[model samples]
Target: MDYQIARHNMVENQVRANKVTDPLVIAAMEEVPRELFLPESKKGVAYVDEDISIGNGRYAIEPMVIARMMQIAEIETTDVALVIGAGFGYSSALLSRVAETVVAIESDATMVEKAEKILQDNNYDNVIVVEGDVVAGYPKQSPYNVIMFDGAVAEVPEAILAQLAEGGRLLAVVREAHKVGVARLYEREHGVIGHRDLFDANVPYLPGFEPVESFVF
Candidate 1:
């Protein structure tokens, strides 16, 4: 299907056109074979500017959304990263290119298996897919230089924020109630974690991250 051409077009038209200016981010998006990360039935449409479901209530978020998040995080070559809700491990693969090491957490067993296989087969050796509770954030490897939520969440848990290194940055699409989501970049400076809205996003919520229901009068 001429994936190379399709990939080039996706970078130039969907990602680059949307203000994802970081050269490393652009290069990673251009180099990764996103099609390999999707179900066979969805591969033909891999480069489309929309999320593609990968079963088990997970979606491979739109390329532009992830690209922008990476750029905002400003990942460094020697940083350690943790990706919550790794899904098919596409985002982790992208992080592996820019970060020294990556630990991806996924709750679903099937997903963890598939993600690990795909990553290993493709020689993305810097990333490891761990099967565990997604919202727990792999604290075993605390003090991550970068933490990314692969999907939208109602809130960012303090436990997750605690994993960020003093100068680390975390990125997530925060959606509350039914309102539109906001992509936020959280930074830890002087032991304080603060966040600023980067852009508006409306992507699927990672399982286990849904807001708790409240009682009504």
Candidate 2:
């Protein structure tokens, strides 16, 4: 398969055509070999304009959705980023291009191992894939300039928000069961965190982020 051509077409046809205007995000998407991040069986469909399951209920979300989220976050070249639910570390790879340093958290041991190998092999030196609970957020390196959830979640925990540096931004697709998801951005300023909806998305939810069930009496 001609991956370079397919990548170009993906950027022009799916991402750029969908209002993802940030040049940095566009360039990262164009440069990163997204196919390398997918299972071999799924690589042929890597550039399709839809989420590709990566097992354990996670996904490498649609390119346009991630691009729009990055654009909305306004990532800076010197910023430190934390990617929750790193999966195959694709999002972290994209971020490594634009951010100074990236810490990606994944709960699955096998995934962490594979993601680390792929990032290291590809020379994405700025990214560090760590195995840990995704919901906990990596507080050891708190006050991150940007925090991105790699998949949809039912809610954003305050603990995660607390890790945001003043003036930092966190982006996630917030979706409740049987409800539509909205891409939301949370920003911290003057010690206050405020969030606003960016766009609607129906991406899959990351494990351990599902809403707790309530039982009717």
Candidate 3:
């Protein structure tokens, strides 16, 4: 069996079950080659309805979770997007279909190199994969209309909030211990307003974003 049939089944059953009705996201999952982002051994697991292990204890976000975040972000063709933990650039490629330009950042050098190669090979010129610890957010390319964290995090840092353009939105799956929840946060005029609990699901945690420290007596 090929990934095409599996991917389609995934979109219809798993993704649609999670309320991912965006036609664009569904189409991307069907057309984009998910296996191309995996190692040979894990190629068979590409359409397995879960994260693809990419080494360093990291994994790409499940397709349905990505679709959930992207759908709530309400992507626009002209919006500039910042994708944290780009893995092998699959999300960046999909985001490029909606966002005008995509800044795909990964803290791992090997993943960065691999993402760049994959993107170049696929002719994804609108995306730039950077190697850096910009998990909080990439400042050099600040003021993005959309910021999507492919993995779950304990908190959304101000560094990432600062990167959002006025009225821009940041979408992430936040983990509080055993719980995992999705949020779509907007940078409002005075402050940020988040509409959390879009759904409850499991996603791998992003590195470098552990919970903030608290004072002790």
lDDT of each: 0.94, 0.94, 0.81
TM-score of each: 0.98, 0.98, 0.90
1-217, model 1: which lDDT tens digit per residue? Answer: 9999999999999999999999999999999999999999999999999988999889999999999999988999999999999898899999999999999999999999999999999999999899998888999988899999989999999999999999999999999977899999999999999889989999999888887778899
**What residue runs in model 1 are displaced by over 4 Å at the alpha carbon?**
none
lDDT for 2 in candidate 1 is 99
lDDT score of residue 57 within candidate 1: 87
lDDT per residue (tens digit) for residues 121-142 in model 2: 9999999898998899999998
How far off is residue 165 in model 1, in Å? 0.3
TM-score for predicted model 1 compared with the true structure: 0.98
Model 1 clashes, total count: 0
